[model samples]
Target: VLAFTATGFVVAAFGQALGIDTLVVRNAGAIILCLVGIVLLIPRLQDGLSRIATPAAAWASRQQSALDDRAGLWGQALIGALLGIVWAPCVGPTLGAAVALAAEGKDLGEVALVMAAFGLGISTVLLVIAFAARGALARWRGRMMAAGGRGKIVLGGLLLIVGIFILTGVDRQLEAFLLDHLPDRVTEWSTAF
Candidate 1:
């Protein structure tokens, strides 16, 4: 978890572009994310997974559920980390595009610094969403339960958009916009630190 972004930074430092592998990872991750969202949103698929669980090992499923229940916040944190892992690839194109821009006519330290910041930003968002949403959902259990199915479907559609964008190499437009809008002071600070 800690080294995930550092790995990206190191790669950028080496100027090694695993262009195809990165695309593969981004696409596969997107597809899997969409599938997860679909399974959660679709009653039929959800029921099918439950049915599959039953024949595989009824007691194991129940025991796992119990363990999840008992593990509480720690379990939730682990799940959050897993979610971050799954979704990390969705941001790959953006990060890569950003790092490349930052690396252009720059030294290795500068490239790494940019990538490290991007990685921290990505990690922070995932962690915040995971923890904050958990609390919010607990408070709004009834409303959330009602909207949960629809939410997952919306999320799935969003994932598909991100996936398609990366696959098509359209994320560079977003990267361009971000770089254009980034304040000069921020760039100065990034350089200074």
Candidate 2:
């Protein structure tokens, strides 16, 4: 995840150096996010994904365990890495914004720090949920299973709001407003990091 974010930062900085316009990027990202949101919110698409997932799971279950414990460990790590990329749409904007901020400095060290911080922040949430996942899943399995079909709708609703904000420029404006009003102490603390 750290590597992924670092790469994003580096790429953004490179793009900036090549004279790509930030406004163009912001608009493009907003449009893509909105489209994704629309697709997710479509009931038919959710139904299609569900239909496909079942057969795919059954096929996977039928496959023999080809890997020993050691290989299995590495295979799982690889799968997790791939899954992170698959999940990037959910996180791309925040990372992009951070990358753009880092690019302003044109300093490789600053870009690395921004990327590291972004990765660390995201990993913290993931770590907390992962640590508590077993218990949560065990306790809520039946309920979660029951609600599975609706989960996509819930996620879509959230993404729709985020997309709307980004599309209308409210998201960036709000971020800028917050930054302007933020306490110097807080900014200083972050800089200390």
Per residue, candidate 1 scores C-alpha lDDT tens digits across 1-193 of 4344555555554434544354465577767765766676678988898898886687856755776899977776666566545444556554565457545756766655665576677678977999889878788999978787688778767766765665666776886787689998877785563
Global lDDT of model 1: 0.65
The TM-score leader among the candidates is 2
Cα-based TM-score, every candidate: 0.53, 0.66
Reference-based lDDT, residue 28, model 1:
71
Q: Against the hidden true structure, what lDDT does model 2 obtain?
A: 0.69
Residues 24-68 of candidate 2 have per-residue lDDT tens digits of: 766676777666667678978757777979998777545424432
